[model samples]
Target chain A: MSNQEILNKLRDTIVTQDIKGCEAAAKEALEADISAFDAINGGLAVGMKIIGDKYELGELYLPHIMMSAKAMDGAMGILTPELEKDKTTESIGTAITFVQQGDIHEIGHRLVSIMLSVNGFNIVDLGVDVPDETIIDEIKKLNGSKVLLAGSALMTTSMQGQKDTMEAIEKEGLRDSVKIMFGGAPISQKWIEEIGADATAKNAADAARIVLKLMD
Target chain B: MTNRMTPPERMMAVMTGQKPDRVPVVPFVLGYASKVTGISLGDFYADGDKCFEAQFASMRLHGYEQTPMYGYASMGAFEFGGEIEYPYGKGQGAPFVKKHPVETIEDIEKLEVPDFKKELPGAYKQADRLASRCSELGLPVSVQVGSTFTAASVIANTSEFVSWLIMEPKAAHSLLDKVCNMFINAIDYFAEKYGAENMLPFDGGPSESNTMISADMFAEFAYPYMKRIHTHLKELGVNSVLMHPCSDQNKNIPHYIKLRNEIGWSGKYVWLFGPETPVKTQVEAFGDHDIVCGNINPSLFITEPYEELLEICGQNILEGMNSPSGFILAAGCEFPPNAAPIKLMAMLDAAEKYGRYE
Candidate 1:
């Protein structure tokens, strides 16, 4: 098969959410002498973009996105090591994602993290029920580098944790270097403005675009 | 002008599709009541008397039409012999499931519906006391039979439950059936105690929202169980039902309407929707047969200034007042516990100013 054809197979695996197929395609790309970077950017990332657009258009739902993300992760598992050997991996920017303290609903947070990762962002995933102090400590570790610190909450009670995390960032003098975004069922653009956060997105796909713009 | 109807009378008028003196304002106020009464939500959920007292006081303070009712989102876990944590800390909202009973497929086989009378949790005990108090005061006894799907989900981890709907349909069905049986048992208990004719059942649909699952998935997993529970409610001679479809459920409306029609459960469906579905859309869908209530964004209470809150509440009242069956202004979902009290008052004030009948 032609190298381009092999790359197309990689893309199809993600769009179709064929997890095993994605792993096989990654191997085929490796054998066909396709560069890992090209296999990712030219194939897997393109497929992710398709699924992301479909999700944004409401043609795809959570399970589809989740399966597609799993497919992408499988392909990345095969290609990441190869890319690392080349020492030429490039990322868009770093994003620190978490579900706010006292909330365990991480579906939205996981979706955003998956979208950002597939869009080439280095993700620091702080899992659910993360406190403000822990979030600030992660921000401190980012050390003045431009980062997108995103948090989500499923309940109104936990939603305040987002505000507290953002406030803690400001109190620790890390506000200027970081972009703060909040998303969840209860969050709104008006709430973001009220809480003095940087941005809010309608959904995970939109979150990727907003993070990209904020990074730029 | 002095009001011609008391809160109960106004609510009853709307429930029966008779013209009320004004539109009813029934905000889903739960923990917010505790916040108003200056009690720790931990204490509030633990003590039925306090929970009812706080809710009643908040109702009187706001002068809204609905009285205090006992129920929380994290319901099934505690009732099913799992653990739950109440909103005790600052900014803590409502009670949440601390542990799930049926964590695995094998656990589902071992699961038994607890005798609610024997294994009553804090909330259930409190609900019992609340109902007793209502009965003592000659008020209608209110009980919860909501989102059998949500209760089932709480019994397991939510994500696991959603995944089971797709991956393990049999297990999902088994769990849902068990939950329905549990609900039926609870309904029987409540009905036998309070007399079904004098009871009102509160239902909420948070897990079934389109944002969480596809409408097709909802139809498959949530619909049948909801039908079963409502059918039981109907069988028990319960006439009035208040259902809150808590979030964006435009896609799920047809299924809900179908359930209502199939079961022939009509009248005051406080079918309050979340802000994701507009009031106009809800009225257009449910206005003819059910008392359409709510669509006011709950976030507005915390984020928006008083003027904005008033304007939003007023807009919803305008859209909902002319509902053929009836209309009751309400927050889209549970009123935020941390929201400014004045914002809730804005809803009542809006109902009075803009919701009056000619």
Candidate 2:
């Protein structure tokens, strides 16, 4: 098969959520001498963008996205080693994602991480119920690098954690370097503005778009 | 100015499909009660008397027409023998599942309907106290009959349970069935204790929303079991039901309407919708038969200016005022626990200013 045909197979595996088929397709792409970078950009990332768009259109749901993520992971497992060997696997930038402190509702956080990672952003998922200090510490470690910090809170009580993290970030002198994006059931553009956040996403796809724009 | 009917009388008028003096404003205030009333969060949840008193105090202080109630969103974990962390620290809300009971698929078989008398003595005792207090005050007794799918998520890891919907259908159904039965049992206990006729079952399905699951998934994983529970509620002679289909659930609205129609719960049924579903849509859908309670954006209470809140509430009231059943202005979900008091007052003021019936 031609290289384009092999790449199409790789993309098909992700869209269909064929987990085992993804690994086979990734290997086929490699065997056909398709560059891992091309296979991902031409194949997997294209498929993920489709998934993201479908999700935004409400044609897909969380479980489907998750399944697609698994398929992406399956393909990435086979392709990452090759991509790293070619020294072309560098990420666009780093993103820190977490559910606010005292809030463990993390489906939103996971979705953001999945969208960002597949879109070539390195994701540092601090997991759920992450403390404000821990988030600030992660931001501090990134130092002078431009970082996208996405925090979410599912409850009204936990929403204050985002504000606390913002204050902590500014105090550490990392405010200018970090662009904070907050989203959740209780978060709105008004809340984001009130808290001085850089952006607020309506959904995971919107989150990727917001992060991409901010990064650019 | 004095109203023709008292708050309770106004609520009853609306519940029974008669136009009230004005639309009742019932914000879904929970832990916010503890915070605003100076009660410790731990005491508010763990102590039923304090919980009841604090909620009452908050209502009276705020001067809203809502009755003080007791229940939490994360209802299954503690009842199922999993540990839960109460919101005692800053930026915390309701009790969350600290440890899920079913860690492995093997644990599914071990799951059983816990005896509220034994396994959850604390919760049972607290609920009993709450019911008794409500009965003493002639208020509707609160029953925690929230969504089984949500509880099932709490019974296991949420992501794991969600994946089980696709990867392990049988396991997901098994867990869902168990939680559904568990909720039914809890309702039965409350019914037997408080008398089902006097009890009001408050159910919110946040995990079942389109944000997490699709309408197709809801039909498969949530609808059948929810139907069973609502059918059981109908059999129990419970007339009043309040359901909050939380967040972006326009797709699932049909299933909910179907469930209500199937059970013939056309009267005294309240749908408190998230802002995602406009109040106009809710009234258009269910207004002919049942009370449509809300569609206010709860987040607006904290962030939006007071005038903006008034406009939103005013628009909702205008859309819902003409429903055949009735309408009550309420927050789409639980009013944010830390939302401003003035914003809540704005909600009530909007109802008073525009909710008056001719």
Best by TM-score: 2
| Cα lDDT, model 2, residue B246 | 78
Task: After superposing candidate 2 on the true structure, give the runs of residues whose Cα lies further than 4 Å from its correct spot.
Answer: A29-36, A81-89, B1-3, B117-124
Q: Give residue B264's lDDT in candidate 1 (0 to 100).
A: 77
Candidate 2 CAPRI-style tier: medium
User: Which tens-of-lDDT digit does each residue in A1-216 have in candidate 2?
Assistant: 888888888888888888999889999988888988989889998888888899999898888888888888889999989988897567778999898888888788888898887788878999988987888789879977768888888888789778888888888788888888999878888778888888988888999988898898
Fill in the DockQ of model 2: 0.73
| Highest DockQ against the true fold, candidate | 2
User: How well docked is model 1, in DockQ terms?
Assistant: 0.50
Model 1 chain B — which ten-residue stretch has the worst lDDT? B114-123
Interface RMSD of 1: 2.1
Model 2 clashing-pair count: 0
Residue A182 displacement in candidate 2 (angstroms)? 1.6
- Candidate 1: the clashing residue pairs are none
